[model samples]
Target chain A: MTDIIVGILAFLGTIFVFLAAVGMVRMPDTYLRISVTTKAATLGIGLLLIAGAIYSNELAITAKILAIILFLLLTAPVSAHLIGRTSYFSGVKLWKNSVMDDMEGKYDTSSEELRSGFETDPEKSKPTKSSG
Target chain B: MVDRIIALDLIITTGIGFISAYSILYDQPALLDVAMILALIAFLGTVAFTYYIQQKNKQ
Candidate 1:
């Protein structure tokens, strides 16, 4: 029974990882590629780790697997966000067919700040001027 | 250029980590350590690359 569970999990994990690779190749732009791969790869590895933990059934191995899963889950989003932000700031263009860019005109290139799109009054959102 | 390179590096590192998970099937648990370290390196690498890009843009 345990063997069957492990096989199923490992199979699913492999499939997701494979799909992540395909998405990385097929996605239209850098941002789209990053978004797809990060989520898919993270989940794939996490499931694989869980399967390993179950198969091993050792205290040390299971704990290590848990730690790895936690680390992957926590870091994947952060890395994806960093990559996307850097790509955007460095002027990587969006796909031609992209309908709407929520980040459009929101980034202040001079100060490297992003103004809030939700705020109606732009001046009210600014930090108080430092000095004259 | 940098974006594509970094994204590709991330995916490849992830693939390597996934492969290391296979050690468990063969009853070699030590390789899990490799997977753990790879995860750390991938995150640090992304952070460093992003910082480099940001600084480059600031100049």
Candidate 2:
């Protein structure tokens, strides 16, 4: 019974990990790619870990697994958000097919205050203004 | 979209953890050792990567 269960888990974990790799490499945008790779990979290794924990029944190992799970749960989304937001501000264009930037239009362009203040520093603008 | 996927991953990981604990309590010492290592590695990867992800965001 135990062997059967372990075999099944190992098989599933391998498959999921494979998909994660494929998705990471093949996805169109960095944001989408990271999202897929992280979530899928997280699940795959998590299963593998659980398999190990069950086989050993060590309390320390179980505790470690719990910690990992907690950390992943807390952080993956924030990472993806930061990366996506940074990439956007850095001028990596979103996919043309992207329909809605929910964060969009909320940025009222007419407001100079919307600009990151450091970007328009007197010294830097002086050069561009002088050139013009 | 990613939120749903992450939620799903959390569920599966938790379930797998329970299953692993069950296996450990049983007689599969080999499986138990493997599970423990896998658990450690997974936790470490998530924690490390979470930091990596967060740092990437900060930059």
Candidate 3:
């Protein structure tokens, strides 16, 4: 019974990991690719680790598996975020059909700064300032 | 740019995990140790890459 469960989990994990790789290849832009790969890979690896722990049934092995899973969970998203931010800053263009770019006018590529909406329009703030 | 690198890292880590699990299934204890070391290497590689990206972006 335990063997059957472990095999099933491992199989599913491999499938998910494969899907993530396919997504990475098919995605149009770096941002979309990162988003797809990160989510799928994290879940796949988590499942795989769980399977390992279940199959081993040994305290030390299970503990190590849990530690790896915890490390992966905590770091995966953060690394993805950092990579995405760096890519955006580095001017990796978005997909052509991408409809809404929240960072469209807010981010300055040259300076690597993100400006508030109010800061982008001088006219909006002119009225509030009094000439001395 | 860095997104691709990170994605590649993730794929490699997943492969390592699979290999580790395969070792356990085969009753090869030494291979399990290798898997643990690989996992640690992967984690450290990610951290280093993140730091490199930050440094590159700042300049």
DockQ of each: 0.62, 0.12, 0.51
Task: Tell me the lDDT of candidate 1.
Answer: 0.77
Candidate 1 docking category?
Answer: medium
lDDT of 1 by residue, A1-132 (tens): 999999888888888888888888788888888877888888788888888889898999899889988988888888888888788878888888988787777676667677666677878465432211
- Candidate 1, clashing residue pairs? none
- State residue A47's C-alpha deviation in candidate 1, in Å: 1.0
- Residue pairs with clashing backbones, model 3: none
Better by DockQ, candidate 3 or 1: 1
lDDT of each: 0.77, 0.53, 0.73
For model 2, how does the per-residue alpha-carbon lDDT over A48-130 read when each residue is reduced to its tens digit?
65666555557976776666556555655655565455444333455667776544422322231133334556643321211
Candidates, ranked, DockQ: 1, 3, 2
> Regarding lDDT, does 1 or 2 come out ahead?
1
Give the 10-residue window scoring lowest on summed lDDT in candidate 2 chain A.
Answer: A123-132
Decide which is better by lDDT, 2 or 3. 3
Q: Report the C-alpha displacement of residue B54, candidate 2, in angstroms.
A: 12
The order of the candidates by TM-score, greatest first, is 1, 3, 2
A1-132 per-residue lDDT for model 3 (tens digits): 999998899888888888888888888888898888888888887888788778888898888777777777887787777777767766678888888767666665555555656654685433321111
lDDT of 1 by residue, B3-44 (tens): 565566556566555655667657899888888887888888
